[model samples]
Target: MTHTIRNLSTLVELRSNEVEKLQSEVAAKESLRERHQKTLDKLTHLYESSGASGRLPMALALNCGDYKQGVMAMAAHQKVNLSMHEADMAVSQRALTAAYVKREVLGQVLEKHQHAAVTAQRSQERKQHDELATQLWYRGHK
Candidate 1:
């Protein structure tokens, strides 16, 4: 039983490690998403601030329009990419949570096994001590 419990504990530890790995992956994806979002925000701010200017050469204005269109396209692409990363992070988070729960349940089982073994040992010791005391009392009285 002890050997089996030890094996189970090892398995649970492996699962915990897997959960940690998944958590790290999720964090990395989140970081990537944040970076993409920041880039999109910067592009948006630039576009908005550009509109504040009142006058421009007609040729320059047409060029600026083209530049703004390009920036908008890039921002849209980044937004879509960020959303995909967010979805991946969510999936990893769910998997990590499930793994953690399984490991915790196994840990509780391992603890129970140890506790039961100790309780049995103590009960046996108490029985032996009671028997020995009773024998000594009878011998002394006789």
Candidate 2:
């Protein structure tokens, strides 16, 4: 019984540590998600402005000697912006999924811990009851 109690205590401590680690990871992911969102927003604004401005300046800046080269540079920049936007969306989605999974995992761990504690308490109570009953029977015999 003493060993069982000790093991339960150890398990509780381990679970607590795991929960803390998961919490930290979730926080870090959230921070990353926020940063990614900001980058995505900035990229969106840049893309909109570039479109409004006709993107000629960007093409000329790229040293595209011909109209074809200029157009290619503009196309490349647009493609890059689109790719970044997609990547940001993916990262945000993953972050959200991680958060949900972490919460669910934590909930399950807490529920398991509660059940273990309850079972231990009930077992201890039953042991005490049996001991008391045994003592009473012995006293009556005496």
Candidate 3:
């Protein structure tokens, strides 16, 4: 039983580590999304502030249009990527929650086993002491 408890403890430790790794991955994905959003915002701001002001050379107009189109495409792609990351994070969160619950249950079982062992030991000690006291009483009466 002790061996089983030890193994379970080790499993719990491993699961905790896995949860940490998943959390870090989620953080990284969130950071990526933030950066992408900032890039999109800057592109939109720049285009709005400059591209709408006046007519330019044909070449310059075409270049500006291409730039706007490219930024829009990148924004779309980033939106999809962000959703994927959010989905992944949600899945990881669920897995982490499950792992924590399992670990908690195992810890409770281990505590109960320890408590029972202590109770049994105390009972045995009490029985031995009673027997010794009874023997002493009989010897004195004799």
Best model number under TM-score: 1
Give the local distance difference test score of model 3.
0.75
- Report the lDDT tens digits of candidate 1 across residue range 48-98: 777732377888888788788888888888888888888888888899899
Please give the RMSD to the true structure for each candidate, in Å: 2.1, 7.0, 2.7
Write the number of the candidate with greater lDDT, choosing between 1 and 3.
1
Candidate 3 error regions (>4 Å): 1-11, 17-50
The superposed Cα distance between candidate 3 and the true structure at residue 39, in angstroms, equals 4.6
Worst 10 residues of 3 by lDDT: 45-54
Each prediction's TM-score against the native?
Answer: 0.87, 0.43, 0.76
lDDT of 2 by residue, 1-142 (tens): 4555566566556666665666666576667656656665665554455443345587664543454445555656666665676676566666656656665665566567667878989999999999999999999999
Better of 2 and 3 by TM-score: 3
Better of 1 and 2 by lDDT: 1
TM-score for candidate 1: 0.87
Kindly provide the TM-score of model 2 when superposed on the true structure, using C-alpha atoms. Answer: 0.43
